[model samples]
Target: MHPLISAADLRAWLARRPETVLLDCSFDLADPSAGERAYAEAHLPGARYAHLDRDLSAPKTGRNGRHPLRDRPAYAAWMGRMGVAPGVPVIAYDRQGGMFAVRAWWVLRWMGHADVALLDGGLPAWQAEGNAVTADVPAERPAPAYPDLPPAMPRIDAAQLQPRLGEVQMLDARAPERYRGEVEPLDPVAGHIPGALNRFFKDNLQPDGRFKPAEQLKREFEALIDTERPVVHMCGSGVTACHNLLAMEVAGLGRSRLYPGSWSEWCSDPSRPVAKGAAA
Candidate 1:
C-alpha cells in the first residue's frame, strides 16, 4: 500500500492520472548541488526536484550536527513549494534505489504525512523499464492541506545518548571500515562510539535496491538485539542514518530514534571519546 509506486507501478499510475507527482531525489553527498544539476538536465515528465542539502536540511550550525533536520515550519513551506498537498500521494526516488529517498520518506512521516512512499529501485529501475524522460517541469498546483509534525521525532541528543550507552541498542549505520576505524575519510577522527554495533545502511536493501520484506528485516534486526531495548541509529553526517530507521520500520521493528549529530558531531567535541577497532 505504501511506497505506492514501483518503477513499473509508477508507469501504470502515470497512465491513469495526470495529477501524480514524481520527485527526483537524486543526490550526491560529496557534491551537494549535484542533485539539482541532474534534475535540471533531465527528469521524468512533470517531475519536481528535492535537493538534499538546500531543501531537505537545515543550515549547519557546526555544533548542531551535520545535516540538521530542518524546523517543521520551514520544511512545511518547502513541501508546499514542491506542490505536495495532503491528499496527493508522493513517490520519491533517487540514484541508488531508495538510498537517498528514504530520508524524504522518513521526514514526511516525521511531518505526520503517511501518504509518502519511496520509488523502489529508483530512477535506474524506471529507465530500465523504458520509461520516458523529459526536461519539462510541470505546472505548479495549489498547495494541499499540510499535516502537523509528529508528537516527537525519533531523536536523541548526545547528552541523552551518553547515559544510555550499552543499555540500549545503538546501531552505527556507517561503513564497516569507518565503524572499525580502519579508515577515516570524512571525519578528523575515525572509529565509532563504544558499545555500538555496525549495520551499514546498505544491508537493509536487496541487490536490486528494493528493501527486503518486513518479515526478513525483522528477523535480521531481531538477531541483533532483544527488540525490547530502544534502538538508536547513526551515520557519518546523520543523513544516511535515516535509512536504517526506515529499514527498521519496514522490518516492523517500529520506532527507533536517531542520533542527529551522529559521528561528525560526536567527534567534534574533544570530551567524547572515540573507540578504535571493533567493539568487544
Candidate 2:
C-alpha cells in the first residue's frame, strides 16, 4: 500500500471501517504546547492526539538532539496504550505540511508495522474539504504487549555517517537558509554537513499543501542522484528528514536510510566538519 492516503479516501474508509486508527500528529517546534491546544479546539473526528515532544520523542540530554527518537520498548508500549496493534491500519496527519506526521509514519514502520500511512495534505486538506472536526477524545483501549520486533526501517548513527559521506547521497531537508549557514533558529549549528545536498522538505508539496505528483517528485530527486543510488536523509533533529524519506518512497526512488542524530548532534561535536553556502 502507498505511504499516503487522500482525505477523500480517508473519509470513505471512516464510513466503512470505524476501527481504523487516526492520529493527529500536529506540532510546532517553536511552541511545544500549541499542537495540543489546537487539537483540543478542533481535529478530525475520532482522531487521537500525538504530541511530538511528549509521545514521539525521548527525554533529551545536552549531547542529544532537541527531539530524539524514543526508546524502542517504551515507544512500543506507548503504541500499545494508543491501541495500535500490529496488522491494524493506522493513519497519521499534521497541520504543518506533514513535517511532523511523517515522523509518526516512520516510527510505525520502524516498529515493524506495515499498514501505516500519512494523511495526504494533513489536517488542512481535511478541513478544506469540509470534513467534520470534533474535539471529543477517543477512549483508551487495554494496553497490549507490543512484541519485540526487529526494526524495519534503516537508520545510521553520527559515527557511521561521517565516514560514508563521500560514497552515499547525503540529502538535507532543511530550508536553504539553514543549509547555507545564513540563519539557524533551532539548532546550535548554522550550516549543514559537507557534501550534503539541500532539498527543503516543503518543496515536496504543491501550492495546495499536498505532495507533488509522484512523477514530479521522481524527476526532482533523479536530478540530484540516480533513482537506485543509496541515499541518507538528515534534517534539524531527524524529524523533517523523514519527510524526504517518505517523499522518496512515494516517488519510488528506492529505499533510503536516515541519519537520526542529524545536524544537532553533528554540530554538538565541533570536530565534525560543517559546510556553508550551496552544494559544491
Candidate 3:
C-alpha cells in the first residue's frame, strides 16, 4: 500500500481485515491534553488513541529537546500492547491535517514496522466520506512477540550535524516567522540552523487538507533543496519534521534522515550557531 490512504480505501481495508490497527493521533502542542479529550468525544470506530506526549515521545531532560524518542525496546513494547504485530496493517490519522499522524507513521517505521500508513486526509476526510465515528474505544489485544531488530529510520543529531552545516541540506519545517526569528512561540531561540531552508510542513498539503499529488510534491521539494546533498529534516522539537519525510516518500524521493533533536536541541546548546532573518 502507498504511504497515504484515501478514506474510501481505508474503509475497504477495514472491511477485509477488521483486526487492522487504526490509531488516532490527534494532538494540541499547547494544551497537550486536548487531543485525548477530543478523542473521547468521537473517533473512527476501532481507533486507538495515541497520545503525543505520553505514547509517542520520551520524557524530556531539558537537554534532549522537548520530545525526544522513547527507547526502542520501550517503544516496541507499546506497539506490542497496542496489537501492532508484524503484518498488522496500522493506519494513523489526526485531526490536524495529519500533522500528528505522520509522526506515528515515522515512529512506527523507525521501529521496523513496514505496514504502517496514514489516513491521507485524516479525521475530517473520514467524516466527509459519510463514515460514522464512534465514541466507544476498542480494547487493545496483546500481539505476538517478535525479535528486536535495528531501527529502520535514519537520524542525525546536533553532534553529527553541526560540522556538516552547509554541506547537508537541512530543511526546517517550522513556519516562515518561526524560521526567520521574527516570532518564536516555542523554542527559546528565535532562528534556524545556518544554511537551513524553511518549508513549512503545512505547505505539503493541498487546500482541501489532503496531501498534494506526488508529482507536485516532487517538484516543490526539488525546487526547494539541492538534491545532490544529504537531506535532514527538523522542526521546533523534531515532531513536525516527519511530515516532510512522509511527503518525500509520497513523492517517491526515497527516505531521508531526520534530526530528531531538531531546533529545540540545537538552541539548547549555547555553543551551536543560530541563524536569524530569512534564508540568504
What's the true lDDT of residue 254 in model 2?
76
- Backbone clash total for model 3 is 0
lDDT of 2 at 99: 93
Residues 154-226 of candidate 3: C-alpha lDDT, one tens digit per residue: 9988899999987899889999999999998877878999999998999999887999999999999999987
Per-residue lDDT of 1-280 in model 1, one digit per residue for the tens?
Answer: 3543578988887787666667788998778788878888878888888888787788987776677788888878888777777667778888875767877877777787767777777877788899887778777774743556563347788999988777878899888999999998888888899889988888888888878888898898888877887888888878788888877777777788888789988888889878988778
Cα TM-score per model:
0.91, 0.98, 0.98
Q: Could you say which candidate leads in lDDT?
A: 3
Local distance difference test, each candidate: 0.80, 0.89, 0.90
lDDT of 1 at 220: 87
Candidate 2 — worst ten consecutive residues by lDDT sum? 138-147
Candidates in order: C-alpha RMSD to true structure: 2.1, 1.0, 1.0
On TM-score, who's better, 1 or 2?
2
Candidate 2's TM-score reads: 0.98
In model 1, state the lDDT of residue 131: 86
How would you encode candidate 2's per-residue C-alpha lDDT over 1-280 as one tens digit per residue? Answer: 5899999999998888787788899888888999999999999988899999899989888677887888899888888878888777889999998999999999988998888999999998998888989889878873585777888799999888888878888999999999999999988879999999999999999998899999999999999876677899999999999999999999988779988889988899999999999998
Off by over 4 Å in 2: none
